[model samples]
Structures are given as C-alpha cells and as structure tokens.
Target: MKKSLAMLLAGAMVVASLTACGSGKKETTAETTSDTTAESAESKTVSDGETYKIGVLQLTEHAALDAANEGFVAALDDSGISYEIDQQNAQNDQSACQTIAEKLVNDGDDLILAIATPAAQAVAGVTTEIPIVGTAITDFADSGLVESNDAPGENVTGSSDLTPIKAQISLLQKVLPEAKKVGVLYCSAESNSEIQLQMTKEACTAAGLDVEEFSVASSNEIQSVVESAVGKVDCLYTFTDNTIAAGMNTVTMVANENNLPVICGEQGMVEAGGLCTYSIDYYELGYIAGEMAVKILKGEAEPATMPIEYYPEEKCEFVGNEETAKLLGIDISGLE
Candidate 1:
C-alpha cells in the first residue's frame, strides 16, 4: 500500500510539471506576437492603405493659381494614395487667408498646401506642426517660409515659381531693343512683388535700361497707376505679382489702348494680355510640390529635410502673345 501511494504522488507531480511547462510556452508565444504587432504598427505608412486628409489654401482665383491647384490635385490622383482634400480660396484677401488657415488647423489636416506666398505665410503663422507644401512662391527663405532651400529646418518645403528673372529681362530687351526705359508695375503690398521689383530694377540697370516704379497698393489703383506709366516709360514689365495677375485685364487694356508693350513674368500673364515671357509653367511647379507631398505622407521623407524644388529650366518656354504683339505692332519674328 505504501509503494502504491508513493507512485501515485510521483505521477501527480509529473502532471503538474507538464501543465506548468505548457503555460510557460503559451506565455512566450503571446509575448512574441505582441512584439510583432507593435513593430508592424510602427512600420505602417500612408501607402499602407491609410487615408490622409489634405488642405489647400489658394491666395486667389486666376489662371496661374488655378492651373497650380489643378496640377496638385492631378498629382494626388495619380499617386494612388487614399486621401481627402479640402480646398479653400482666399480671393486675394489676407483676412480670408487667416480665417481659412485657422479652420484648417482646427480640423486637423494631415498636410496643408499653400498656393501662394500670402497663403503660405498665413498658414505658417498658425502652425509649425502641420507639414506645409508651398507653390507659386519665389524664395522660401526670403519669405520666411523655410530656413533654407536645401534643408527647410522647419515644417515648410515646396516648389518655387521663381521664373528666370535675368532670362525674362533678356527677352524683354530682345522684344523691344530700342526701348530705353521700362516701367516696373506690381502691387506694393505683396512681399514677393517687392522682391521681384528689386531684381527687375537690377536686371534693367545692368542692361542699360532705366526703370520707373509703378506700384499700386491695391487692385483698385491698378488702372490709375498703369495709366500714370503709359507715356513715362517705353515698356511695362510686370513679374509674377498676384494682384497684377488678378487685374490683368485692366493692366493690358490700359497699356494696349496706349500701344504700350507689357512684358510679363509668366505664361498666364502673357496669355492674358502681355507681350511675352521666359516663363515657368505654374502647373509643373505645383506638380513638383505635390510629388514632395507624397514622400512626406509615405514616411519616406520629411519637409524639414526635403530640398525645395523648381521646374527644370530646360522645360521653361519662351511664351508670346501674337495678338498682343500684333496689337502693339511689334516684330516677334526675332523671337521665333
């Protein structure tokens, strides 16, 4: 009886040990599974079928800005990434830009696309956390949007619509070789305009052409300001000024009535009524910005480190308005 009892106790001990071993194995498997789940969560990116929200704040409604907006959308559509976009236009109003920027921030968008300098400035004023991709902007560092073109050092980076200034000036000289004085027409309110104005003056001076300033504080003053420049200067040169771009009809009309040749900064302005430009495509510029946006979303890059982009110079075209050229009776045959 004693031997049987001892054997039974040993058997019971063995069973208990087996049960404990099974529990230990189960716990180890569970820990490994938990670690793997955490690693997977960390590795997931926007490309992993996660939907992203994008907000676009455009400064105004005009052909150039419109084309940029369209190109940005087209890029996202082609990216095959799931996303929802909220587009807002400021109508060239700074107050409107501020309001829309605040709304976008409160709504928690994954990213924001600022179409112009003012819009970018508005968004930058509101948030430093949200990634900002700007287009139609000349100099990011000069605009205080980024720390540098090579390394943003902040949450802002995008393509610059900085057309070849010297090239445009050369084209102007080619178009009107006999002209001695050029009127630099732009909105004084826009910082970008001021920056371009200074560059234009330098370029004109270097080319032995005198430049006269014709700046307007608002679109309301465009007519009077442009009229004031009609006989004072030989030709009018306007850069990528948003205010002038919005009021191109008035600018071209007044200049045209007086037979003044207006050399524009970009293709849209030339298309609207100006004579010609060594122009950069705003659509292509925006597309470049959009591509940058994709990398940011995919966790493949960060705006703080992404270099500012620009449309290839080789792709820039010398766009001219034949009708405007005909109206002004200028020989653009040399351009062709």
Candidate 2:
C-alpha cells in the first residue's frame, strides 16, 4: 500500500510538472507570435514611406524658361509624391550654370531637372552618376547630351522642344515668297542656336534663297549685328535663342527700321515681335519632362534607357503677332 501511494504521488507530480511546462511553452509561443506580428506591421509602415529631393537648373529667367519651370513644379505637385524641389536660375550665364550644377550635385539630389540646353550641358558636366532630365533641348545628339536619341544609352534623357525647323522655313517662305536673301540671327555661344542657324542656313540655301549669317556673342552685340543685317537681307529669322530672344525689342526695332519681316522659332519669340512661327508649346514640353522625371525618381525608368521624347506635329502651332504684322505692313490675311 505504501509503494502504491508513493508511485501514485510520483506519477501525479510528473503530470503536474508537465502541464505547467506545457502551459509555459504555450504562453512563450503566443508572446513570440505577437511580437513577430507587431514587428511586421512596423516594418511595413517603414517600407511604405518615401521621400525625394529634386534639383532644378534653369538657364535663364525668360518667359519660355519661366513657363517650363512652372509646368515642372505643377506636375510634381500633382504626382502625390513626397519631394522637395531646389531650384536656381543661371540668368543666362554659363559660369552661373556651372556653379548651380555643382551646388545641386553636392546637395546629393535624388535627380536634376535642366530647363534648357545650357543648363543640361552644365548638369551633364557636373556628374555622370546623377540622372538629368532636360527640356527645351533642340537636338540631343547635337547638344552632346546623348549618344543616341533612342535608348539614350547614357545618363541624360528628356523631352525636346525641337520646333519644326523645315516647317519654320516654310512659314517664312510663305510670308516672304519673293524674298531672295534671308538673314539668320542667334547667339554664337548657344550650341542649340548654332544648330538652328546651320539647319536654317541649309534649308534656306536649298530653297534657292541666299543666306546671310549674322552671329552675336551677346545682347550687347545685337544692335550692331541686327543693324548690319537688317537692311541687307530681304527678311530676318531667328531661333528661340535665349540671348537673342531676350533682346528681341532691340532686334525688332532694327528690323522694323528697315521694313524687314521677322520669323521666329517659338510663340514667345513671336510674342516679342515676329511675323509668325511653327513652334512647340514650351509649357507642354516642360510638363512632359516633369512626368518623365516622376518615373525616373520612382525607379520606374532609367535615364539611360529612357528614349528621348519629342512633341508631334500636332503639338506644333503657327503663332503670329498681329500688332507686329500691322507695323511691318505685311499682309497676313491668308494666315489668320
């Protein structure tokens, strides 16, 4: 009887100890599971948050550039992406552009948006590692921004406001059908403008019109260059070169004195004082660039792989200044 009682006590003690141990193990497992669930939720919240810093370098403070800058910011705001835009205008100074580019690079920007050819070139010189999205670039390859427009295959990519060069020539020819000699005006330092001058020269030559090239180093040279060419060529034409466009009143004054008609590369150019133009929408160009930037910042697209985009002919419009038309005494009745 004593042994039986002792065995019963031992068995009961073993069962009680096992139950306590099992309960302890169950409690530990529940606590571990609860911790893992909480940790997972915390990690998910951390992963869901994102922030970006964007740097913008604009070449000048002209109407076209200002519009582009506005469009870019508006698009970024509309994307619902958390970001900060650090913007600086170069004021049409090459050295200023370089300084701005260096500052943006040093700030460790997530990306850079260049608003013109000079700004893009400046940013491209700063870093190959930082992606650059450029708008209002006339020629990607000509500007030395990329190896190819398709599959840029490099660190630079964006939209081009390359207005229809040939169409511009056509518009000029329509307005001055009998004009034999056409004078081209632009800034010599602007590679974009140089490209336009060359293309325009070629187009005019092909059209059997004599081409007179007049180049200026800056706005200060505009008066002399225009004065010399205004009376010489039957008509005057210029691209949306920031330098020349900025001093347009001086140019129109000279051209007007000679009763010369002016054809321009953009609406802003015409708004200043030109007969007409086949041009791209500067705001839309910048807006498209902004959208591309969002993709790049989100890691959805790489600048190297992103194809350089261009506006279609439909996006191109014929804009003219009627006030200037009346002043020049040019019959634009057919164009309206």
Which candidate comes out best when scored by TM-score?
Answer: 1
lDDT by residue for model 1 over 143-188, one digit each (tens)?
9998889999999999998878888889888889899998999998
- The alpha-carbon lDDT assigned to residue 95 of candidate 1 equals 89
> What's every prediction's RMSD, in angstroms?
10.5, 12.0
Cα lDDT listed for each candidate: 0.86, 0.82
Give model 1's TM-score versus the native structure.
Answer: 0.85
C-alpha lDDT (0 to 100) for residue 72 of candidate 1? 85
Q: What lDDT is reached at residue 259 by model 1? A: 94
Tell me how many clashing residue pairs each candidate has: 0, 0
Candidate 2 is scored at a TM of: 0.83
What's each prediction's TM-score?
Answer: 0.85, 0.83
